[model samples]
Structures are given as C-alpha cells and as structure tokens.
Target: MTDSSPLDDNAFSHIMADPALAGSACSLAVACSGGPDSMALAFLLSRWCRDNGRRLTALVVDHRLRQESAREAETVGARLAALGVRVAILVREGPKLTRDLQNQARLARYGLMLSWCREQGAGDLFLGHHLDDQAETFLLRLARGSGVDGLSAMSPIEMRGGIRLVRPLLDIPKTRLVATLEQAGQAFVQDPSNLSDHFTRNRLRRLMPTLAEEGMDARRLADTAKHLSRARQSLEFYTSQHLNRSGRLYPHGFVRLERATFLEAPEEIRLRSLSKLVSALGGADYPPRFDRLQRLMKRLEADADGAGTLSGCQLLVRGGRIWLAREPSAVSGPVPLEGVGSFIWDRRFRIMLSATKKWPKETDFFIGALGIDGWRQWQNSGREISGFSILPAFVRRGIPALWRGDKLVCPLSTQKSDHWQDHGIEEIHLIAGELFGKTAFSSLNMRTM
Candidate 1:
C-alpha cells in the first residue's frame, strides 16, 4: 500500500483548511473507538492541532459490550496520549445484544461523550465516519424506500443533543484510514461484531461492493446524498414559512390554510407543510405514512363530509372548515377516586393529589375523593355537589368511588359538572392533524419517526 501516513497528514490538513472548519476557536474532541477509522482520525487531529495551534482531545467511549472493551479504551487512550493529545475515557454500562439495547447504548455513548466535552469546555465533537459509511447508509435508506430526508444520509455537520457534530473524515475512504493506521504502526482494536452478518449495516456493507460492480461508487453516492440533503433543507424552510404565514392557533388546536391554500401550492410543498403542522403538535414521534396522508388529503378535497385520523390526532371536515382534534382517551372504564393518590384513568389522563393549602382557587375543575371522616363533615354542612354516589353494590365490592364534597359523584366515566366545565375542564388540546395533507405526513413520518 502507498505510504498512508503522509496521505493521512494531507487529508487532515485539507479538512482543517475547509471553510467550514475555519474561524472556530472551539476545542476539538475526536471520538476514538480504537477502530482503524477512529484511530486514523485521532492521529490526523493530533497532527493538525500541533500545526494549527488548536487544542485537540481524544474521547474514547467503551460500550463494554465485549470483555476487552475497557482494555481497548485504555489502549486507544494511551496511543492518543503518546501523540501529545489529551485523552478522556468514557465507559458506558448497559444491557446487551438486542436492537433496542444497541440503540440505547449508542445514545448513551454520544450523551456521555458530549457531556464530557461540555465539561471540558469543548465546542465541537469530531466523528470518524468515512465516505463508505455514508454510501452504505444511503443504500440502506434507499432499500427501505425512504423519502428525501432519509436518502440524504449522514450530514457533514449536524447539531444534535446540544452539541455540534462534525464528520471531518467523511470524504475519505475506510481503506485509506486502515492503510494509514498500518503505516503509522498503530495497533487498533477490531470489533468482531462489525463483521457479523446478523446486523443490517454489516449486510449492507458486504453487498455494496458487489452492487458497485454495476457502476455504483462511493463518490457518486455521496454526491447524491449531498443533493438530497440540500433539497430536504429547502423544502423544510418553505414549509416553515408557509405555516407561519397562514397557520391559526386556537385554544385547543390550530388550523392551517383552508382547503384553497393547500390546493394552490405544488404537491410537494403542500405535503411538506402538512407534515410540519402535524409534527409540531403531536411531537416528533408522531408521523403518519404517505399513502395515509395522500388519502386524507384527497378526502378533504373530494368528500365534503369526510373525517380521518392519523398519528393519534383526528382530522374533521365540517361545513368548509377543517378541524384537527386530539383523540379522547379510549379507556372506557371507571376509576374510583379515593383519598389523595395518583391515578392514571385512561393511558392519557393522570390525576394526583395536591395540597389543599396550595390549591389555586380559580382552578377550572376539581374531583374530590375524601375518606369517611371528611365525607361525614362535609355532609353535616349540606354542601351541594353534582353526580350520583358510587353504587352501594360497587362500594361493597371494593369498586372505586368518586366523591364531590360529601356527596358520592358518578363513576370515573362521568363528565365533570358545569362548574368544572367552566373552569377549563372540557377542552383538552390535541396535537394538530396533518393539514398540509397526506403526503406531507407520510414524508415526515418516514424520516423523523
């Protein structure tokens, strides 16, 4: 192989010279896993720091999945320390093997790394993902039939979890990194799990080369990812502007432009707008699929009396106006209120006891669950409370009882009294439904959730 050490130095200098990296006095924290790619990154950053008079730190995260992870972390730390770079080792302790566990571990790894960087006064975290990783990601997303945002793959730089993540080595090839490590006599730990066919990423990496024989290459794939990223960014910008201009917020929900506004924009822009609105209200986790979004949008235009639900929010077409409402909790059972305790009636409604001393007088709703002593006292005073008392049979069977003042109120299913209604009891804000229509919901769900 060509002398990889010189090539590593050249690549490092090139990245530092990039306009994106210039003018930031931010200290750099290289995420070193002791893998060849990360080791190469550590070496490059160390050299760059010495030349540019910038501070560099190597962060080694031990996921502790393997028996040797702690050893590996120490070995990597020593290697970086030998290069005159400060080293910080982070150990992540967690569950094993399962997909969910792996994801949780990944999150913990980044969280710990970023937290350490923040504590050390570092502003940027440098990752060591190379062009091959990007290309593999794009192919995997494409295979899943993801939309523009998914196809965009990993970004060169992204702000995540309050830390700026910069992939300075994305343009370089993994082979080149390995070669550099070999030339530098770097002893990097190889994670055997990477070669396991059981992982989807590994499967994709294995297949990419065979598929590349049909004229695919990392450079071209990376370029496609870059293009998709730009397109996704532009669409997001347009959607935000459209919502700000035409969206109206109500006490319980918000409405985007009337049907006319959606019909005016191009299909892509309209879909993007709808996705944004749904995401804003439902939280990022709620995203409806594309076909569902398209069907909902068509229904809005063609079926004047149509209504649909997506992402746990409901969309209603009434008399020319579109209304989005949160779905009421589906739990139909009654909850017996007893003294002060936290009760989750439906999966949605949660009630807890607050001190009467601190209770606000102007509160909209109050449901009382008093013990016998309190009930007898209120009863002697002749307090007027609404609703029937818990059935004697239910009380006998230890079924939950609801009480208002001294009187027994209806079961948990009963609606609160008018006095409670006037206090902001009846209206609950549901996340806004997709008003930009079906396509937007679909695209947003694919990438975000």
Candidate 2:
C-alpha cells in the first residue's frame, strides 16, 4: 500500500490474469466519476491496457443533479487523458430536485454508461467500488433486512445482457486508492453531494465509525460481504440447476414447477429455487419480495391455492404445481405504427418499433407489419375464426424482434402462449421488461447479431 505505487495496478494485473480475461484481447470500459477510487482505477487500467495491448475507454457520467457536475466530469476527463486513457463524458439531464432523485440519477447515470459501452462494442465494463464501499453496502442492506442476495452487497462480476461488469478492486481499501492518487499527483474532485446527509449512504457513512467502535471493523464488514457473496453465488448456482431440472414451460403464458420439489429443499434453497422459477417465468421484472415469497411458500405447503402478485406478475399454486403468469395490462390497444414508439405488451413486456420505408439494417428481428393481416386472412379462408377469436388483435407496427438471433420470431409472450401456432413475420418488436422486479431495462445486456 505504498503511496508512490499505483494500488490499482496490482489489482488490474491480477484481474487481467484471470481465466475470464486471459489471452483474449477485449476492449475495457472504466466507469470513472472523478472520485479518488475511480480515478485510481482509470489510471491503473490505462497503464495495464498499454502494457497488454488492449483498448481502454473511460466513461464519466454527469448526473447533472449538481450545478458543478458538468465541470467535474470535464476535470475528470482531463485527468484521465493525462493518464493516457480515452474518455467519454455523458451528461444526464432531468428534473433538478425531487423525491427519490438520487435513485433516479443513479439509474440515468448507469443507463448512459452501459448504453455507451454497448454502442462502442466494449466486452467488459470496470467499476472502482472498493472494500469500504462493499462493507457500507452490506451494512445498509442488513439494516434494511435484505435477503441473502441483498446482503451480498456488490458482486465482483456480473453479466448484463452481453456486457460483463467486473469490479477488480472490491478487496482494496478506499484509503489505499486515495493515497495512490495523491502520490501520482492526481487531483480528484470531491463531490459535495457525498457529504450531504440527504442520502441514506451518507447517513450510514456517518454512523460507520460508531458501528466500528462496537467491534465491527470495516474490514470485518467487507469480509462479511465476501462471505455473503460466496453464499449467494452458491445458492444461485444450485437454484439454477434445480430449476433446469424441475421447471417446465407451459402454455397460457405461465411456467410451472413442482411445488413438492421446492418445498422439500432446505429453506434457503427452497426460497431461492422458487425465486428463480418466478424470475425465469416473469423475465427481468419479477423479483419476489421476501415477505411475499415467505407467504407464497407457506401457501404452497398448504392444500389451498395461494397466490401473490407484484409488479404485474402473478404467482399461484394449484394442483401441486406453481404457476407464474404475467397480467394483461389495460394499456393494450392498437396504435398507429407511424415510426418508433413503446407499446406495452401486457405488463411484463413493451414492444419498441422503429419503422423505415427501406429496411433499416440493425440487430433485432424484423418482419412485415402486414403479416398479422395475412394470418387473419388465412384464418378466414380456413373457417378457423372461432378459435382465433380469442387471440388479441395484432397491430401493424415495426417487425417484432429481440436484440438477439437476427430471426423474426413471435413475441416472447406469444411464444409462451398456448395458442401461438404461427411463427410468422409480425411487424412488432417485443421489448420485454426486466424479468425480475428491477425497474430499468438498461441493466439488461442486449445482444447484437
């Protein structure tokens, strides 16, 4: 932890040596906020890229919440440039101040950064959250009575859509980053918002010293986070394995799982298994609340049907199988397919369409908008309108396609539906919501063909 040596250099080298990154020339994007921790990360990553012949990009997100945010990003960009890192600055503008502004700002910031990484073809994005931050996050989650995953705080690596997010300095100390930055003659901007008591994190930081006095060292908290992370990873792995073995996709836009199998596992495993089952069925927007999950589990053990609904997803236990279903939204209606607009497909998905006279070449499945009419015409010819009457009217818009597999297929809901027989080229792009109860779709990694 010498001041003269870059603390993050060791970390960056170690991460590069990881089997995940070994021998592969991948572009790396660093999320820098002009803070000491991030600045040190950018400097070290820049040097590592230079030595390893890998491209490095630095991203600074200006939340635009504070008046000085733009200038701070510029200063951070200048500092990164001095360290030989290419920098990209993104400014997020929105309401100046409001309830939950911090959370909104965070979403916007990450949204801009991740979107930039995708657009730039970066394989991985690096963040500079250190041990102290992990400890703080753990404590906060603990105080809020979070589950194992929440208690796990931050993960070292996470896969979103197609981007791999890696935090190489999670084991390092914030003090070490500050010392390294100081020794490097780097001047980092101290965000005044961090010191303000307006945020829960700030309050936790203020209380950390007292908590540490009670024999809870920040290092110990960091260790706790690591332990939780390991435990969570194990639980998730087991859950995935079990789900693959026991879960089945059924018609009627529901996924079914054996209730007995889930109930027979250990409580933790049971909870995780159920959660994962619901998540897989719901897509990215279905995070089961702990209380709701507990209740659901109890009902599953009972003979009667017990159901829970959250964020437009429904979980029901019936006839020894648990079914997860997405609710149809009142917003379902046909709108003109003039150009690009977001159409809510039930509650679990939104379809975004960008139409052009000439085929707009990009990733995502595309089909003729009139294909639905063709299907109707075929149904009329075959006298199959009776069964087909139950089907929702398909509006002509842009071709339906996910960001993966350059094939025009039916919407995910249609694929999940029981009566979805035709896989024709329908001019509708299905933008599925977060499968878990996460609010933002930006966290998802969109694959390009």
Candidate 3:
C-alpha cells in the first residue's frame, strides 16, 4: 500500500466504499488524541468528510488520570479547530484511577466518545487503531487461548450501540502515520505511558522486535488474524441460525428455551448461543468467563430440571424447558419519574407514568423493582395472580412500581387503575426489557486480541 492510503482523501473514500460504510451514516465522529496516529486520521478525515458533504465531529476525551491530561486535550482541540474541524473535549468523570488503569481509561474513553456520538445522532465512529495494534492484539489473544473470534483481532467495522465504529487505518503501519505527520509539518504529543515497562502492552511492544527477528512479523500475524476473522464470520452465520430456532422470544423481557433442542446442537454452537443469551439479558459487554460458561453448559446438558444464576441473570429449568430472566438485584436502580411521560426504567422496561393530577412535582413519585417488602404490600392489597406464576416471580422484584409515599401504588401485576395505581392520572404499564428486542451478540467483539 502507498503511504498516502492511510490518510489520503481518495484512500479514505475507498475504505468507506469498499467496506460499504459510506451509506451507513451521514456524519462521522472521530475519537482523536494529539498523538501522531490519531492526528493523522483527524487531518485526513476533516478534509475527506467536508469534500463528501458529511459533517465531522472529533472527540477528545480527557481521562483525567494525569494532571497534564486536560492540557493535552485542550491542545488537541485547538489544533483540530485550526484545521476547521469541530472538536469536543469530553472529561471523564469517575473515581480515582488505581488498579487496571489501562482498562479503566479505555472504558472511560469509549463510553464518553460513544455517548457523545449517540447524543449528536452520529451513526459512524472512527478510531485510530493501526496494523501494529492489531498485531499486538492477536498476540494477546493468542496468549490467552482465545477462540477464533478472539484470534480474529479487530474488524474493519463494529456496530456498538447504534454506531458503526470504523477503523480506516488498520492496515497502515505506525511509521507511515508518523511520516504523514512529518509531511504535514504537524506536531503530536507522546504519551509517557507508552514507554513504561509496567504496562502489559508496553512489555509486548518491547518483545515485538525480537519476535519479528524470529520471523513473526506484524503483517504475518495480522494476515493470520484476517484469515481467522473470515472463519469467525462463518461460525457466526450458523450461530445466528441456532439462536433463531433454539428459543422462543417473549415480548415480556424474557425467553423460553426449548431445552432439548438446544442441547442437541453441537458443543460450539451451544456455547455460542448460551453466551449470546446471557450477555443480552445481563446487559454486559462480554459473556461470563469460559470456565463458568462451561460449567453451566454441563449442567444443562445433563437434562435435569434445575435453576441457577450467572452474569446477573436467572436460568430456571422446569418441565423440560428453560426460563431466562434478569436478576432484580442486577437491574438498574430507582429512576425518578420527574413528571408524567414515557421513560425507560433500568433499560429493562419502558414505563409510561401518567399523572392523575394535571401537574406533578419532582418529589411526587419514584420507580423501582418490587422487592420482598413491596411484595408484602402487594399481597396485603388483596390481589392474586391467576396465571403464569413463575413469570410473575421472575419479575416480581424487578417489575416497575410507582410510589408516592408508603402506598403500593402500581406494580406490573396490579390491574387497578386508581389512586396511587394511576400514578395520579392514567394507567401504568410494566413492560419487559426485551420488548424492544435484544441486540445481536457483539459483546465478545472486545479488542482483547
């Protein structure tokens, strides 16, 4: 590849077109730092996006770990602004960084950037992960004994939340990025952490030269990863087929697994299916660890009726089938109604709380799960559920309930639409989490390798 392909307008256009991502979004949001690689990307994208009539938003996340971080972000923003690109500095607000600083910093960076992209209605997000990063990731996942997906390293495009995260320079070498900066007479900051021996990645980078001398170069590794990525895509196709047939999706935020048919599938397919389900309901990025997942699979394979909890979700086997539900303790906490309108509670339910009064105050009501105490109140109200006893128990603690004072108000089970039940106005609907449909299994798409 030519040196300009990493940042040239024609190259950028080709990358977007070849990947079929040009039509996926109308605007581009780039995660940029003042580093050589990201600055090169920002410089290229700024011109490319403008030429294509696409708006560009560059986000600089100040992780706030070091005192100099804010200054760095400001400098980066100023430089990008000079290039006629819109820049936003997002300061990560979190507790003091201690252990696992790299992981924490990463999560903060992506979380802030992705949130900003979503808020701006930006459908495409770009990052500056190069071929070197891909090679390091392959080594890391190889060391961890990861499956094909892990060994696949990074994809050209990944769908996160509602955004398509694009990596345009993944095939470009780091030297090229620096050369691009040099050619443009642009300056970039060098993070001190990169040279630190304390970080695993730094250690790995130090080892790469020796490994390359032994004939394990970055291109060879990245090529291997690309091959594995294709194989991984094949497995995903079958996995999707299995998911569609293995379980009955319920509109009430749960699923009914046809246990026998699920167990009949091959081991790999079975594992993948279960992992996707747990991740979807648990609202976690990755499934449980391999050991934990294996143990759960063993129990399920025995075909014995039983129940267990893992990854913040409950799996109960009854009458030769499985019922999957979210653990109440794991769901989101109380979200204040604020007023009368539709709002998502814990991402598990879309609650519509209409007030009986024409106007409602902020202190008027709160929404949360119906725990044991709420259950007692529900029983004392002289009510009984006549059907689907197991279903009610599954969501009882987590069923959205609106309360003004000590009164039970309206829980998911209550049919009465009056008094506190009305939430001061109209009826209350306790919708399930899966009502909007569970997203595809992208949790394992971590850049571990």
Q: Give residue 300's error in model 2 in angstroms.
A: 6.5
Task: Rank the candidate models, highest lDDT first.
Answer: 3, 2, 1
What is the C-alpha local distance difference test score of candidate 1? 0.61
For model 1, residues 30-144, the per-residue Cα lDDT tens digits are: 8988888888888888888888878998888888777877887898899889889899989876566556655667777887887786556576788889888899889989989
Q: Which is the winner by lDDT between candidate 2 and candidate 3?
A: 3
Candidate 3 lDDT over 211-243, as tens digits, reads 888878888789999999999887867776676
- Backbone-clash count (model 1): 8
Error of 3 at 15 (Å): 0.7
Per-residue alpha-carbon lDDT of candidate 2 for residues 233-325, written as tens digits (9 for 90 to 100)? 777766655655555432223455677775667788777766654554443322567787777777677755666655444566667777665
lDDT at position 23, candidate 2: 32
Model 3 TM-score relative to the real fold: 0.76
What are the root-mean-square deviations of the candidates from the true structure over C-alphas? 12.7, 8.2, 6.6
For each candidate, the alpha-carbon lDDT, in order, equals 0.61, 0.61, 0.73
TM-scores, each model vs. reference = 0.57, 0.67, 0.76
